[model samples]
Target: ATTATGGTVPLTDALELAQQGLPWLMVFDHAGVPLHLGRTKRLATPAQRLALIAALRGCSRPGCDAPASLCAVHHVRDWNTHGDTDIENLTLACDRCHAMVHDGPGGWKTVTLDQDSQFPGRTGWIAPPHIDPTATPRVNHRHHTSELLATTLARIHEQRNQEREQRQRWLSSHTRHTHAA
Candidate 1:
């Protein structure tokens, strides 16, 4: 497909080009090391890249349901600080979550399973500033409750009713004005 830049390139063509002529070998002379193609020049085997992409196809956050294509690949540890460009250290985060990670006043924090007893076998990752440091983090069950779902449905119904009432009032006023004219 052609990009906005008007350059047309097929995936097959790009892959064929990448495979041709030992590209990594050519680039190694400039940097004195085998360079990884995608994330930050750190050496990554093809298998690792594929795994990372698969992991990113779903939302990086533990409970978030956002699709991977809607998210950005984030460095769990900042890349510039000598963080390894490995799948284990990378995550896919939605834009809001990604921004919360980097720009929050206290910075982002991740709780490994070993660190927290409550979230055993799962890494608890939290976006900063919104997270309360002093309070123990707990999963919000209310967000998943049937009552909450019903409440949301009721609110939507109420809004539609208000809109219908407003429309009826407008039509009545217009009709009266037409009759008078």
Candidate 2:
């Protein structure tokens, strides 16, 4: 199979299932060609949104600190032109950057660079080959640290809730025994 980057790679059914799930949106090409990006009928799923929020943090543009909450989910590929509303093809963009992407001064395009196992779903932008003399790739560092912290906090909350429930059950049993006596 071929990736968006035009590289040849072997894709297994297991890999695809592990990668994306069809809930609200999906696209299929029965012609046996995936030259163009797939399209989505609905917006991103909640899980997909959360994943992108953690992954992209905020705006995928370099140096933009717009929080994911305030930013809009953008289609890296044009929505009208075969872009799917999946997490893989979606990124967060604040009002200004979102406009710039669609109507910027020099014409820029958003692209998803292959991130290491360390970071998943990271987004980026690149100039057209003709526009960019060197075509350097840029990575956004918005949510990297925050996401790690968030994960730790979530674990703590879960543990606390479990402990609280356990304690409440014990207290209830003790009170019943005391009243019976």
Best by TM-score: 2
Of the candidates shown, which would achieve the greatest lDDT relative to the real structure? 2
- After TM-score superposition, the amount by which residue 10's alpha carbon in candidate 2 deviates from its true location, in angstroms, is 41
Residue ranges of candidate 1 with Cα displaced over 4 Å: 1-49, 103-106, 111-123, 135-181
lDDT of 2 by residue, 1-181 (tens): 3332223345575347536863322222432212333344433476566555544546777777677777787888888878888767888888887876654457667776664633334566766456676766555654345455766899999999999999999999999999999
What count of clashes does model 1 give? 0
TM-score, prediction 2 = 0.48
User: How many pairs of residues collide in each model?
Assistant: 0, 0
Q: Candidates' lDDT values, in order? A: 0.51, 0.62
Q: What are the per-residue Cα lDDT tens digits for candidate 1 across 68-180? A: 45666666667787656665566556687676555447666543334346434222465454566553433222112343566689999999999999999999999999999
Model 2, residue pairs in steric clash: none
Give the TM-score of each candidate. Answer: 0.39, 0.48
